[model samples]
Target: MTLLIENASLIMSVQDNGRFGFMRFGLPESGPMDWRAFNHANRLVDNPPDNACLEIGFTDASLRVEKDALLAVCGAGYQISLKGRKMPMWMSFWAKKGDLLDFEKTPGGNWAYLAASGGICSQVWMGSRSVYAIGGLGRLLQRGDRILIGKSIHRSRWDAGWFIPQENRPAYDIDISAGVVPGPQYEWFTDEAQTAFWQQKFNVTSRSDRMGYRLRGENLTHRTGADLLSQGMVMGEIQVPPDGQPIVMMPDHPTTGGYTSIGTVCRADLSLIAQAQPGISEISFIEINLNDARDKLTKTIEDIDKIEKPQEDVWTQL
Candidate 1:
């Protein structure tokens, strides 16, 4: 199977689960902006949970099928059509050879994922297919590009038993109520600032993307008035620049930073930030213990797993 990039504003190279165990080498995890949707798209196509999928950003994207294929889309609801017929978002469907797939501007979230049966064929680097935009490694897609398709084992049909229920689908929201934990520089902030951080709401600025999200909120000042050396940073780390606004780092974040980080966003709520559309309202934070954070993430994985496996009856029908 193959996919021809007929027209698209921007499409990134293969972005799978992510590159892991290399943060020590000063590398950041460059994966799906909305991992929940990436995994969901793969599940819909009967591919492995971590299979590679197309991570599309806010803009027009179009493609043509070179062979029969099963496909699905998830995340920000964008304009999608197959052969002049409107393609439903968050549902698995089939496309025949010569079918044209088109995607317009994103109406909801910041990114979208397009997963085919098996997965998109691309060269893997560092144990992942995720494009590292800054690393000069993986990259955005281009027009007139013919992409290879992996061999699909489940090419038969879809059964209702394997369908994802409406309630199970992920939704887009603005009030990002994410779990926050005190950072190394948390002591530098006064109790008042800390309280304000959680109580006050901040608006997401237009200067946001896969790299980091900048917020326009109350000026958060440090208590100690001290400067610290540049240190390692992680995804979801909220750093306060000299201007006093907190910036939440995302998937394609840098390895190090010089700003003071007052807190870090919990893994469970990272997706909430990832799905935030520009002009969305500010989000509040609640502190949680490390063990609680782990449990919450574990439970989320279990819920996603439920969506991956095909129902017994559904498989039999296929």
Candidate 2:
């Protein structure tokens, strides 16, 4: 089966769980910005949780199904329509050949995920199908791009009408609190800088992207200075440059950096930052110990595992 891109305003690409274990080789894991939504979209269509899906960015796009297919969408700030009829997100739907799927940008979040029943057919690079444009693995989807669809292994299940509960959906409202653990160079910052980092609310600048989010807030001065030998970096590491502004490393961030880091946003809260709409989202940091971070992440995974079983009366009211 094939899916054709009819139109796109910005960039959309295929992203799976992520490219892992290859970061040591200088490859950053480029996956869905909102992982929970991505996984939920896949599960709604009865696809594996980590199956490849369309990662739609902060703009408009549309797709046309060349063959009958089951699909789902999940995330904030976007609306999906089939053949000009509006469809609810976080729920499974069926599309026949020639059906056009339209995605309209809304005002809450920045990214969304579209998953087909069998996942997108794409070449894997470094053990993942995620598109890392900077690394030249795959380019963004464009008009007339024909994306192959994998063969579905499961039978028809859309009649079950699965949906993500409203309470479980991620909120993209203002003044979001993101959990973090101290980075390796946490102590390098002055006490006042550290205090301000936690106390102040930082606005996500328009400069943010898959590489990192440059925040605008009170400058965080470092006692040990700004320049450091380039060291290994990871997703969520909050690195402060000489300008004293913090840059939260993301999935496509470089393998190494020369700035001092104050803390690393925990895995559980990375989605919160990822969904933060640039130029409008305000974020605050909450420090958590390593153990707590791990425990929270474990619980999140457990909750995701339970999504396959539909709960009565839990459908999100559109």
Candidate 3:
């Protein structure tokens, strides 16, 4: 089966759990900006949790189903419709041949996820189907593009719908407090700078992208004026340049950098930063220890498992 893109006002591309184990070769893991929503969308359609889905950003888009299929949409700030009838998000529904799926403008968040039964069929690059446009991995989807749909094991079970509990969804309208752990060069930053980082609120700038988010706030000063050798960079590393403005690296960030990093966002909060809309979102950091960060991640995983296999009535769960 195939899905045809009718219109896309902004960039939409394929993303999965991201390209892994190849960052040493200069490739950053490119995956869904909102992992929770992405995972929920897939689960609604009975796809593997890591199956590739459409990561829609900013604008309107429409798709036409060429065959009977099951699909789901999850994320904030967008409304969906099927053939002019309203369709609820964070839930799975069936569409027949020639059915149209429409996504309206997002008013709160910048990204959303759309998942189909089975998964999107695309060429894998370095063990991932994610579109790292800058790395020449995959291109932004365009109108008239034919997206092949893989054979879904749950296709026969599409008679009913599935939904994520309202309490489990992440909210983007409010200020986000991301958890952070000290970076390798945390001590290099001046005491005042360190204090300001945790005390002040930072606004995400328009220059933000998959590479990093440039925050506008008080400058962070380094105690030592000496320049250190460039070191390996990773996603969520909060690097402060000579100007003092911090740039929080993202999934498509470079493999290494020379800027001093005062801290790194905890792995669990990476998705929070990803969903932050540039120029609109405000962020703050809460310092945490490595052990606490690991524990939080474990708890998040456990919560997700419960969402996927709730003990409630299976037939009336949604």
Candidate 4:
């Protein structure tokens, strides 16, 4: 089976979970910006959580399913329709051959995903199907690209509906609060800067991308003489440069960095941060202990874990 891209989106790529153990070699784990949505899309179609998926960003696009296949669209800011009729998102839906699915962007989030029942087939690179374009690994999706579909886990279980509950979806609120813990260079920032960061609202600049989110807000002042060698960078690390503006690392952040990191956003909120609309979202940071950060991440993992196992087996109905 195959899926054909009729109208290409602004930024579309084939992505799995991500590559691992390669950052030390100067390669970042390039994957879907919103991990939660990506995972949910796969689970809706009974694909393994890390199966390859279509990552669509910020564009009005459409595609035609070459064959009858089970599919799902999960993300924000996109109105999905089939043959001029509206379709519900975050739920498994069957597409007949020659059916055209259109995605229209609205004003809430930046990214979305389309997952086939078995998952989109792609060659493995560094143990991942994710495209790391900059590294010359793979390239962005193009119009007319016909991607092959793999074997799905549930071939005939469409009798029951599957969807992500309202509570489980990403809250694309205009203003969001993200919790983080202090980083190694936290003390390097002035006391006033620390207080202001927690108190003031930062606007996400349009300059941000998959590599990092550039926040424009309080000017975080550091010790004038402070300087350090470039050190290993991690996802969620907050780095500040000569200007007080902070850049929160994202899934595609470089392996190393020179800017001092003031804090690390907890893994639990990374998806929230990713869903934030650049130039529109007002993000506030709150500090928490490491233990609390870990607990929150665990809870999020548990929540996603429950999605893979459907509450009631649709197979039972058949």
State which candidate, 2 or 3, has the greater TM-score.
2
Superposed by TM-score, candidate 1 places the C-alpha of residue 185 at a distance from the truth, in angstroms, of 2.0
Q: Which candidate is the best by lDDT?
A: 2
Cα displacement (angstroms), candidate 1, residue 39, comes to 0.9
**lDDT by candidate, in order shown:** 0.78, 0.85, 0.82, 0.84
User: Residue-pair clashes per candidate, as listed?
Assistant: 2, 0, 0, 1
State candidate 4's TM-score: 0.93
Q: Judge candidate 3 at residue 265 and give its lDDT.
A: 92
Note the residue pairs that clash in candidate 3.
Answer: none
**Candidates 1 and 4: which is better by lDDT?**
4
TM-score for all models, in order of appearance = 0.90, 0.93, 0.92, 0.93
- Per-residue lDDT tens digits of candidate 2, residues 110-225? 88899998899899987899999988998888899988889986454334367776666665576689999987998999999989999999998989888898999999999969
Clash pairs (backbone) in predicted model 2: none
* Candidate 2 lDDT for residue 294: 98
Model 3 C-alpha lDDT per residue in residues 1-318, reported as the tens digit of each score:
999999974768999999888877777888887777888788778788889999888789999999988888988767888898877788777788999999997667777798999799898988889999998887999999998889976554334366777766765564889999997888988899989999999888888877888999998899974257888898889999888898999877898888788899987787788877777888989999999999977766655544443333553323
Misplaced by over 4 Å in model 2 are: 154-160, 308-318
